[model samples]
Target: MRQDTEGLLVRLESDKDGILSIDRYGFIQGINPVMAAMLGYGASELEDKPVRLLLPDMDEDLQGDEWRAFFDSRIERHHDHLLEFVSAEGSLIRLDVQMFTGDGLQGGMTLLCRDMTLHLGAQESVFRQREQLSAIYTHATDAILLVDRRGYIENSNPVASELLGLSHRRDGPFFIDDVLRIKNHHDAWVYPFSQALIQERPVVVTDDIQLVLPGRSAIPVSVTASPVRDRSNRITGCVIVLRTTSESRRVSTRLSWHESHDPLTQLANRRQIENEIFRAIDHAHIDDTTHIFLYIDLHNFSVINETCGHGAGDELLRQLGRMLQEEMVNQDVVARIGNDEFAILLWDRQPEAVMDEAERILQRITAFSIPWRNRRLKVGASIGVELINADSTSEIDVLLSAGAACAAAKAAGRNKINYPSPERDSPSRASLSQWTVRISEALDENRFVVYCQPIVPVKAQRDTQHYEVLVRMVDPAGNIISPGKFIPVAETSGLIDDIDRWVFERLFTTLEALPSEVRTGYSFSVNLSGGTISDEKFRDYVVNRFAGSSLEPGLIQFEITETAAVSHFESALAFINALKAYGCAFSLDDFGSGQSSFNYLKQLPVDYLKIDGSFVRRMEVGEVEYSMVSTINHLAHIMGLATIAECVENQSQMALLEEIGVDYVQGFLISTPVPLNTLF
Candidate 1:
């Protein structure tokens, strides 16, 4: 027995687990080399030392009987537990410990400990990796799903639920067959997920594949299926990804169509027609062939457009385009070139045939009518024919000849055909017409800004400020343009009302943002075009804006030229009376520039008159100019109205205006126009 006991002790000393024995008084009676080395000490140094040196948590005041009770308690309560110890080098050691007390060799206690720090650290690292993978799955852009070995859905991301139309509240052990159904080009089932699982490789389908839901339309997608493998190289499941391609395809097709076709009429547009003309010119030069180009302008079209709405005009144009297309041959091209205008090109036709075709188009347009509301609207066309022969110049010359011929036809009579020579048909006004696009673009891009020049009272006035609000446009190159360059074109193209609205909206909105005292103290003089003053809608818009503004009624004063007021006399009077009833003011600008300025003054209810700059600038030199200014000022005072002299440049002009008793003076002598932002 003694020999057996000695062999057991030798075996225990060589074991990997650390072992120690302590007496009831808490002294280390015996310790194996393993335990001593773990604590960074030798067996001789620790064997006789108190156990409390290693276990700092143990109380040092315990006596022999107290130590006996403590050992007993540790054996019962802390068996097979985790505890911490301080090494001799002041490092931490975490261990899984077991205690034995009754059969201990020293009649105290025995400890067996295994280090657990490395094992627990490895577990925490694996947990973090799983969390990162879960985040990727949940937030991926493409729809993704994970399947199990038995073909059942183990998990899915949020995109998968949305793409497949699955409800999160549903209870299920969902199978891959029920959740993901794919169809090939022939409407036959395609099991990419099952194939990926069986072959242990990725399967991708980019075309002619659709995902079918139970009650919704099938979605076109590019699908990819990849097998999920374990560490042991065995297939466990598959990942399915779906990316949509429907919207991209639709956008591409729409863009391709709009490149050559008009959005309103679905016919060839001007760009397409120009390309065809170039091709025709090239063919004519090579083979000496002839092509006939016809420019068609519809008459009385604006009558329907303005009387009935623009929708009616658009419908009429569409109907006319269809009729014109019916008259063309296979190689012929028909296109809408402008508002209420269409062009047709007939290839390889003689001069007589072209004339007959133009006549037929005239009769066809005159006969066609469209029904709107309770009435039928009919229109006539004036056709201009240009024969393109081998001697025909460039495409631009051909278009110019056609346009000039059309102008001659309109000048003669309605529903007529004319082929006037380009040189005699009145030079092309295209240069002036191009300003329409520039002005429209400036308004759309918000490139216009307000500028103001002070209107100083010649004599000292109290609590009153006045300025003339001017408009300037900023081009794409950052250059400022004066109104004289574009205003004539805007008036001719019926765009002056739009310009007026733009200026009024910007000025009124800015004024509303200022303090009440500032807004009420100043009066702004805004210019009004003849078209704007005649428009009932513009008048209503002004009234509504004034009703909503916080400014005083007298804050905005309208300035109109004598010619504008005289041209639209009745409408101007009504417009003035409507706003004048609302406590607004009006000024007659360029008073003596018109032929009958004084004759119309008796009928006009104005508060101020501005002498024309032409007379004001030469007043210091010419007696006639000076006499005109004095007479106008005397007449304005007699009618109980104030007079403002414009173009007052030098002290001589200012002194002349003061001698004439003018109420206000505005010119370069006072100040040039500055941006509104700076003054405010």
Candidate 2:
């Protein structure tokens, strides 16, 4: 029995197939003679080494989650696949691998492998015996050639002759390698057929392979070669296949050009420019490189396109593309992304340089005009320059910053170059600066007037009512300007406190003129700003002015924004307490709009929590909004505060708010804000 077991062991070790044992950590524990010989290493040298010494990219795969789970669960697994190994000579060797989980035997695995060259020879032998392949070879679109072992062509198809421009050559005079001219992308000669026949091995040549004719353009094609052998395993000849790639190559070239170039302007397109931006971002991340992205708007280009003909507009766009190309340096890229919208990309360019270039473009555009029929069409340019760096948040953030800066330039009357300051300049901020001067002038001339909107109770049984006082401005031409237009400016420029005082004084005078029954029947609400809340002088001035008037605090409700209140926590707390002591009520306007949490609601002495218009206006159409409104209402009720829904535009929104147990609603549905004189 011992002699029989030893003989069996000897036969197993002597087998041509490879076998190896791997520890739980993928170390080579034991290697059979065949595996050691195949790996070009002695048995003692391979043992106790990492398996990755042969298959470097395979170590992670062997210890992958799925592989680990197989072993931990004690689930036996069998898989047959091809594994590639980098041999000592730095050439890839593919083997048919049969791997299995070792049934948790010491928490390890087993691998069996065989070189696929022998299996391929057998498959080719079977393929050669199939008589049907003869017809297939004759009808195939690719060129096929049969050459004998002595390097003489035996048979050829029509395509094989045509591929090499040898359609007129007889079979006896034309040798396959002599008649064909092949080169690689680098224009170096490549003899895949000759080399394959000499080496008695297969070869595949790709990547810009070309076939040259005597007096025509070189055709792009790929060459594949395989050695043919007889059943006795002797090299007989070779089969060379040629595949023309011109059709696919032509299609690919056209598609690639179209993707990266704008058809209209013949410049880089949006996708291509975006790729440039991505590269710039990657460069910035690596070495803190800075770049500039300029958003350009051809001011009133649309009007020119509409007034003049489309042909005239096309001429102007083409001129603009050419003009920009000539104006920019070699490293700069200009793109037309949409109608009348263009972008300029500059890497590592200074802000001052960008500003100078933008100014030159603007000056040139302002001076240059195109003749359209009998009239000359001219337009200005507004460019917004944003300095991009690693500190500029994200790619989209910087892009939006540039867009806002461009919009601000346009808003500031156009024909200008605007670089975003460290502090961003939004369109609203531009309007704020413009209105600041106008607001000061209006205050000097008393152009500010008061408007009021009625707030109605959601429940019909409740009869309490209040009117919110809103402010408007009258221009020199006597046009009534909406509060929405100037209030943002007032708050931003520290004019809200003055405006608040102006509204307070006007209300007192108006109340005194009205009959007592008018004041007794209804109360009034007024919106206040954070500037007024934190101003001690404004608070004292209001106290003294109101104490002297016939206006009782009970007839007034002061409204403050949630964001403003949170910003001036200490001041807001003191102001609310002082106002409440005077028999007045306070409401937190636009309550849920800011990041301030409802957890602070217990500390704020507010009589009302006004839900923001964004959630209230869309509550009927959005389920999440309805649920949100319901939640805010429930929380407000728990805190013993009434809720008012803003921007209740239609009956559906009204009905939803009422269903949610809201106390009141103030929006256009109930009344549009109008001059106080209209009320009288």
Question: Against the unseen true structure, what C-alpha lDDT does each candidate score?
Answer: 0.77, 0.73
State model 2's lDDT.
0.73
Q: What C-alpha lDDT, on a 0 to 100 scale, does residue 398 get in candidate 1?
A: 65
- Per-candidate RMSD vs. true structure? 34.5, 27.6
Against the true structure, candidate 1 reaches a TM-score of 0.41
Give the count of colliding residue pairs in each prediction. Answer: 0, 0
By summed lDDT, which 10 consecutive residues of candidate 2 come out lowest?
1-10
Q: Which pairs clash (backbone N, Cα, C closer than 3 Å) in model 2? A: none
Candidate 1 residue lDDT tens string, 1-680: 01222334544755577877777677888888888777888878888788878765567887774765654465466554655677888776767666654543545666766667687679769967975786576556567888888888877765675566552234566888887888989999988888887778999988798888888778787888999889998888888887766876434433544665566665678777877788888889998898999988787775576568789988888777878888887578888987677888888887667767787778888989875654568998888878888866566556656765776787688788986455544433434445667888999998898998889999987476788988898898989999887776676455677888888888889998998866777888889987899889999889888887667888888999886787566667888998896678999999898655465688899999999999999999999999999999999999999999998899999999998899999999999988887776
After superposition, which runs of candidate 2 have C-alpha atoms over 4 Å from their true positions? 1-349, 352-432, 462-464
At residue 100, candidate 2 shows an lDDT of 48
